[model samples]
Target: MSYEGSFRVWRGDDDAGGLVDYQVEVNDGEVVLDVIHRLQATQAPDLAVRWNCKAGKCGSCSAEVNGRPRLLCMTRMSTFSPDEVVTVTPLRTFPVLRDLVTDVSFNYEKAREIPAFEPPKGVAPGDYRMAQVDVGRSQEFRKCIECFLCQDVCHVIRDHEQNKPAFAGPRFFIRIAELDMHPLDTREGRAEAAQDEHGLGLCNITKCCTEVCPEGIKITDNGIIPMKERVVDRKYDPLVWLGSKIFRRQT
Candidate 1:
């Protein structure tokens, strides 16, 4: 069965915008993206929304549904009552390019700031090997689709625009955690970079990034917290500090 749904969609560009109400037809098993598509087809031909592979893996459809970051294609319409005025808005953390689409280039800049995976010097591409446990650990982080919902929800950049320059946010934190955990990776001082450079200290363990993840990746527990612990241990532990000094001297 289908019903008429009330949707309040934000429309306009960076300089001006407001939520424009629309009464649209909602169908069974349909998602918010579908309704937005309906709006594009019926009423608002100029409505701007970014989406691809509506199956939820592409992460292109990132937006705020009633102020919560979410992939519009994955948010089922059934979650809301028929009469509820579902509000769809652009991700607030980023600048609005237009209706329901924000300039997410901030995430790309953060991605570029992260160092790439460096394999051991002697290990050839085919010869590199890792234990099952290590492979499993890395695989979990590889599941990130780069949705930026985590970044959008992160308060460091969300609330304080000034913090954007210093903070790489949770998405890159997990990336650093992944590389730091790599058994064959030769890069050193990753934890230091995370803390001193990427603004890891600003996190405060809020876990807001983990809450909105569509993939259910334990971003806070599995990635950020462990990295924080490593940072603490490396900075404060006497033995680790001594070992680092000795290693540097020997090298």
Candidate 2:
């Protein structure tokens, strides 16, 4: 069935902005992004929406639909009644560049702060080996498309901008977790990075980030919790502390 509806899309740049309603016709199996493109073609020629692969794989086209973080390309128009108006707004966590476009530079800066992987030295390029079970742990986190939806929904950095400086959000926590779990990684700073002010401690584990993840990454359970466990082990485990000391003496 075909239905005509009005979409109230937030439109503007840094100086000023407001919601501009546009009328569009929707067909069965149509997604919100489909209707948005119609508006761009007919009503607003300059309407800016960032998107790469319309197919849900790109992780782009993220926005807030009726106040919830979601990927426009994945949200079906069928979910809402034709009589009801759908509101599309840019992600609330980042600075607005224009209609449906937000500056996500903050994420890049935080990423730069994370220390890169430092594998054990003297191992030949193909000599490093790891058990399948150990390698499997990080595979889930590797699914992230860098959509930043997890970053946008996270309250530690979303609602509390003040905490941005000290919080790495869920995305980078996954990175840190992946690196920390790597069998070949000789880096000893995982515990320190996780304990830092801008680390895992800031996360209240609200799970909002996980809900909006396009790749269905288990951000809170599989990633954040394991990293937290590592931090706890390093800071409080007497056995590990004593073992490390003895191992150091023997070396």
Candidate 3:
């Protein structure tokens, strides 16, 4: 049976906007993005939907499907009843550029703030060895495609817009944690960076960021929690304090 539905896509430039409904026909196994293309070709020539590598690898084509942040190409039309109207909107966390497009410059700016990796002296180019198990720990974070779905779903930036300035969001926390856990990383001040106003403390461990992560990065459990632990140990661990005092006297 052929399925047909109406998609009420958000349309317009930065100056104005409104929902414009487009009727589309679909076959079994077709995705919402496929239907969107049909609408663009036939109904609305000026419609805009950002996308690349429709196979869900590029992480573009990310938008709020029925108010949920998801990759449209990965979302099948079968999930909803044929009679239902699917509403596609831009990610709510950032300023919209135009219909279904948002200016994600904020994330780029945050990325620039993170310190680059500075490995220890003993770690040679190819000689920086790490156990496979230890290497596996940070590998999950490496799968991130920069979709920003986690950022879109985070209440720290969504519901509480005021926190955006000081909150680095979950993605960067994962980066920090990954580098901090790197065996060769001899850089100091990670604990301070994680505990800074725009760091781990901003994450309330709501796990919303984890839930929206397409790569399945355990943001709260692996990244944020461990970072918090490191911060606590640095500030309050008795042994660290004692060792610091003893080392200072010896020097």
Candidate 4:
């Protein structure tokens, strides 16, 4: 169950870099992160890899395995043929800090933009109660480990860095969707921001984000698309549009 394999790990920093190949030992039940760790131990101790917990919980080991976004600690070495060369690279959407480590601060900036949940007026902490179904829906999004794989795979910003400023990407879309769907949250303007500010309209219903999710969140169908529908309902619902025109107060 042990064999010699190869890995092409990108080596360098923000200024410049390239894929540096290395021959390494592979064993049964080991994941890609294991191979990378082995390379560090014996061959490339200076190799920079950002990993914590090695359990896929911290999500700090996110990288591109053969150009697809994945959690390195979760990708089984057995999934590849014994002699196949596995190429590990930093996330393409973000600036690389070093080998296998990219700057994920974009996600944090997007996270800060999402408004926190606010209860309806007169509602207090003691009065907080959510239906089981609503609570279940919100809980599913909370399962996200902040891996940002969804954001990395999202084509809106993956190929075009210029779009990054306007796009919230899939991860924060889930956050916005969760708050908008929460029955007890009194927050308004999330649906509006999703369309105008967050660029929810850019998504064309491709579920690439859901595919790479270690948590298996139904990011497109359950979160993005539903949020898109709500945004549409708010903007173009004829009855509401007419009601706004007729009933809007004049200063």
Question: Among these predicted structures, which one has the highest TM-score?
Answer: 1
What is the C-alpha local distance difference test score of candidate 4? 0.90
Tell me the tens digit of each residue's lDDT in model 2 across 29-112: 999999999888988889999998888888889999998888999999989999999999999999999999999999999889
Question: Estimated TM-score per prediction?
Answer: 0.95, 0.93, 0.92, 0.93
> After best superposition, candidate 2 residue 176: deviation in angstroms?
0.3
Which of the predicted structures, 1 or 4, would earn the higher lDDT when compared with the native?
A: 1
Per-residue lDDT of 129-205 in model 4, one digit per residue for the tens? 87797678878898999989999999999988889889999999999988888888877788999999999999987
Q: With candidate 2 superimposed using the best TM-score fit, by how many Å does residue 57's alpha carbon deviate from the native?
A: 1.3
The C-alpha stretches of model 1 lying farther than 4 A from their native spots are 243-251
Per-candidate RMSD, Å:
2.2, 2.3, 2.8, 3.2
* TM-score, cand. 2: 0.93
lDDT of 3 at 247: 82
- Candidate 3 collision pairs: none
**lDDT (CA) per prediction:** 0.92, 0.86, 0.85, 0.90
Q: What global local distance difference test value does model 3 have?
A: 0.85
TM-score of 3: 0.92
lDDT of 3 by residue, 1-251 (tens): 68678789999777889888878888899888998888889888788889999988898888999989998898999999989999999998999998988998899999988887787786678877778887786787888888999989999899998888898888888888888887667788887877875557877898988888877889889988988888876776888767777785321
